[model samples]
Target: MNAELVEQYRLLHERRPDYGSGASHVERIAAIIERRGVRSVLDFGCGKGALVERLRARFPEVVVDGYDPAIRGRERIPLERYQMGYEMVIANDVLEHLDAEGYGEDLLEMGRLEPRWLFFNISCRPAVNVLPNGVNCHTLVRRPEWWREVLLACFPGFIEHGSEWNERSKGWMLAMTRPLELEGRRVAIVGNAPQAMGNREDVDGFDCVVRFNNFVVGDGYEAVGTRTDVLAIPACNRAVITPRLKRFTEGVSYVLDLATAGCVQAKANHGKIRQLLPHATIV
Candidate 1:
């Protein structure tokens, strides 16, 4: 990683409250709480502390803390003694940055805390903008099933939450899971390539594409010259207006746009997809 580029990310702690290049991922955590109450919350890699502030504001009753390895500025939690146990631990765009080396220690530290749940987005793909050689910010992006397996191994007994391609809008996957299992945890994908999910049920892909602005909003559309085998959000949400409950909505918008784009390379085997989603591929 370029020093200038790392500094750029630091500055983003100002203008880019969304984190991870407009994909802050706070809403997913917020969404998790909607399903279940979290008494303690930790925002790992909590840049600029915006998402941290958001959580403190919304769930004031719940205890919250912020952790980031890159931050050199004054942080809410002292750098050394920052790690503590919590009910919910959030690692929005933090895990992929671990390719920098020594990230395993950080992972073990979090494990020691043994939070009840881990909500985060791992890099599904890397951005060309950062690396002139065609590399991205992340180094360990295999596939969705691979990610699920890794998370389950790291913290077993937790219900697998969800993963969505944050490709066009950015290159990451939005994920969430809890310690105690839920009777039926749902996956709400907003993209077109439902087949990538392997599970034909909850996977949703569509036949159209959605175009957005610089901020990346879901607006107009384009035709699927080929197939619309992806999941879509607009088709399901039924309403255009979504609660701006947090800064991470932009990331959600990007995932939605990717879904509409029908751009996933991996095609889902209908049987395998059925095991994952069991709902039905939308496209």
Candidate 2:
């Protein structure tokens, strides 16, 4: 970001309480965190740290840090943390505000922090606000393909996501992750039934153990086992959304919501389930 643009945003944020909003992207971000099994996150260009605050609230177990040159509290980028890197790094509605000449360096910085994954939401249209110098806030506005080329150049094999330029939003989103290998791993899908009990030793011996919604092993540890690598929930069913799911995530590496299961309202069901289970990964 340019020095003048940074000052302009700082002044704007100080004056307008709603100038740098991030709550709206929490659900989508949460889903990404769950899908990627991201334990630590760096919120690059985190204006006012709203997204960081919300992320901490939703995923208390996950570590979330924020940075932005304009924001007072989030102005300083932790040099040590950046060197350590993060499981996931997110930049929402922040890249477009950068000066075109310098945004590439900022993108490179984000890539450095993302050893595992990088999530981005970039605007491809002009912003409503103008700086004191009469220049639009979104100076680096460009189409999705342009952004794709930039990302590919920085991080090869990055993938584009569901986001597209909308009349109202005017931006696109992309997500990328390092390749994973799980072909030879032993995986056990345990159901919430009495029949799946009494094999605790065998279940725990697997490389990965998966369970279904509302699975209980309180006193039945000898039966169901305590280890849980993944949790699968029925996204279309409202009854399945419960607080118990939160307790299961401590040892769980992934939480999968069967959002695409054959249903009349699959898309709507997915959205509703995501809102209900904000910590679950919809598939």
Q: Write the per-residue lDDT of candidate 1 for residues 1-283, one digit (tens) a residue.
A: 3354455555544444444433366666786665456687777777656777887888888877776544665334443334556767787766665554455566666666667667767656654334333345464555666666666676654554456675565444545444223224433333345232343432223322222211222232222221221222332332443343123243232223212223352133333234334444434
lDDT value for candidate 2? 0.73
What TM-score, to 2 decimals, does candidate 2 have?
A: 0.63
The estimated TM-scores of all candidates read: 0.50, 0.63
Estimate the lDDT of model 1: 0.50
Off by over 4 Å in 2: 157-168, 182-283
List all candidate RMSDs to the true structure: 13.2, 8.1
